[model samples]
Target: MEGFEIRLTSSKKGKGLFATKKYDQGDVILEEDPLVSCQFAWNAAYRYLACDYCMRQMHYPPETTSIMLLVRILAYIQQSSDPSAAIAKVKQFCHRTENEDAELVHKLLGEQFTHQMNTLREMTSHVVSGDEVQEFLTPEGFCTLMALVGTNGQGIGTSPLAMWVNSVLEITMSDDERQQLDLFIDKLYQYVEEESGSFLNTEGSGLFQLQSSCNHSCAPNAESTFPYGNHRVQLKALKPIMPGEEICISYLDECTLQRSRHSRQKELAQNYLFVCWCERCSSQASEPDCTSEEEMSDEDIDADD
Candidate 1:
């Protein structure tokens, strides 16, 4: 994290990140690790091979991601010895949506998610046995975790070449044992060849504390990326930003930029529970019929994917 500060100000957005000083275009503004990183338990059916820490794709072993995520969560619970603290941290994220049906929508989603968590707990019970994890297995705790992840999670991708190299080095043996390992090596190479081309296929989601506070902007001055190819994300200035500017990142895709103001607002309201009042949205309101090509940019959109 660099050149930014968090403050509770009188701004309509409430708490947000502001520039500490002027930053040039392309300057890295902030870098941070997630408060919690987990595999998309809902997407286990998709069978993507993501990194356990960053949720980026891996090449060698596809089965490790989901199991590793469970292991990490279990380890956190064991080490902290207080599951309530973890739940409290997750509760800090915003889960309110401004949609007309927001309450009903949240209730339905929470119930479904709670059931899923319970099912996951049962499935992993054999491997993860302890009272610490059990404390967080209540219906209420599961719902809280789901709400936090739904509102704040960010998807990350990793490089396949790096994962492949790392996987190869993990297996080693003495000179005499090398002969015995030949068959295993040959099969491993075969698996690598079969899985080689789909390097970027792995994707996972996580929650970042500071990044989550940055509000939405259709024409944002800053953008976020996983520059180190892991869970650590970097927020970079898309253009020169002066001190006191509210750092914003888009919460919708390029396609949203192509839509009219009403349509954009509708999507944002439904998904993020807020109405967009950014510069572009304001301009569009004045020029209802104008389809400005400049409105669209490679802005990162945040939502449950």
Candidate 2:
């Protein structure tokens, strides 16, 4: 299903979408279709490029076919109607409706799309199967892929895309695999329950699908806790959300300096296409003011001299 449609706001960083209505904690944000509709990307990436332990893909591939394969997977997943796709059938597409920023986006998307194809393909081939990929691509691998693709400390660009891949791979339909995933999910749900009661509420049970949309922040107003059952993600409002707010969530829990946050955001933007211009991002861009005790002491000493 097409997820909630968001509109771009007027911001220096180009596009941002605000929630049109009040979204309670654990309320659904937009649900996105997978950009790559099959498990080939996940299986291939994990089997080859990523770390078996951490599942990180930090390098690129050399073969054009591998790159094209990944690109084709991503291209096929795009709805024929989505404006972003060059698919002629797409009557409606995202445009720089408000800003000249549209032009920058147009260029950026093209480059990023091309880069994704190349890098994903390259990353796939570089992994020496036994070194990075799991023995069976079991449920743990599945969830790790789920987490990796969703939002790790970096971002959630791959999770939605990977869901489409899982759907194609029939990862959920195989009775054995389904049971494994179910157990894992159940375990996660339990973890959330033990940690915080508010994370998984009565109305939010099946909303694990929405976990793919939660972004990360150093000082987030929202938080997600994983309980032991159902591998569920429980969302909680750390601060009160106003009506029509974007319903922010954190990618990280600890306090980080502005530069550190920017570094992570940059990683997300480079790896995923979207630039996060969240509250932390804006603060990070500005230079810090001079207000040190050392500076004050030096001033006093100079005055005495």
lDDT agreement with native, every candidate: 0.63, 0.38
Q: Which residue pairs show backbone clashes in model 1?
A: 1-31, 57-202, 98-273
Give the 10-residue window scoring lowest on summed lDDT in candidate 2. Answer: 200-209
User: Residue by residue across 43-121, what tens digits does model 1's lDDT show?
Assistant: 4554556666665554222323333444455566667757778645555666543332334235434547445556765
Q: Residue-wise lDDT of candidate 2 within 125-233, one digit each (tens)? A: 3442332233113333322232233222222122322333345456437788877776876676577557544231211111122443444444565655432111234
Candidate 1 Cα errors over 4 Å, as ranges: 9-12, 40-50, 56-78, 81-88, 95-141, 159-202, 287-305
Best by lDDT: 1
Error of 2 at 261 (Å): 3.6
